[model samples]
Target: MSAETIVKKCVFVEAINLICILMAKCSRLCRGNIYSLLKMSKGSSSRERG
Candidate 1:
């Protein structure tokens, strides 16, 4: 009910929000990296067979 408590709660909520956003971004980046690597290897293998 105090002003200090309200401010602390706001800061905690903001931190949690930021953490969630960063995690989502990191997972998307990781997925892109894995997809690209798989594509490159597949291309190389096909070239070798040809």
Candidate 2:
């Protein structure tokens, strides 16, 4: 293999790793928001029923 090809492969791998990291962070954030929303809804419903 050539040095150029090796560099390209390294870059591609780095890009994929960066994308995966970003996706993981975004999913965690979304999950937290959804969890909080669910908790709020439950609390409101319970208050109404009581």
Q: lDDT, candidate 2, residue 11?
A: 100
1-50, model 1: which lDDT tens digit per residue? 99999999999999999999999999999999999999999999999999
Q: Give the TM-scores of the predictions, in the order they appear.
A: 0.61, 0.67
Model 1 stretches with alpha carbons more than 4 Å out:
36-50
- For model 2, the run of ten residues with the poorest summed lDDT: 25-34
Candidate 2: tens digits of C-alpha lDDT, residues 1-50? 99999999999999999999999999999999999999999999999999
Full-model lDDT for every candidate = 0.98, 0.99
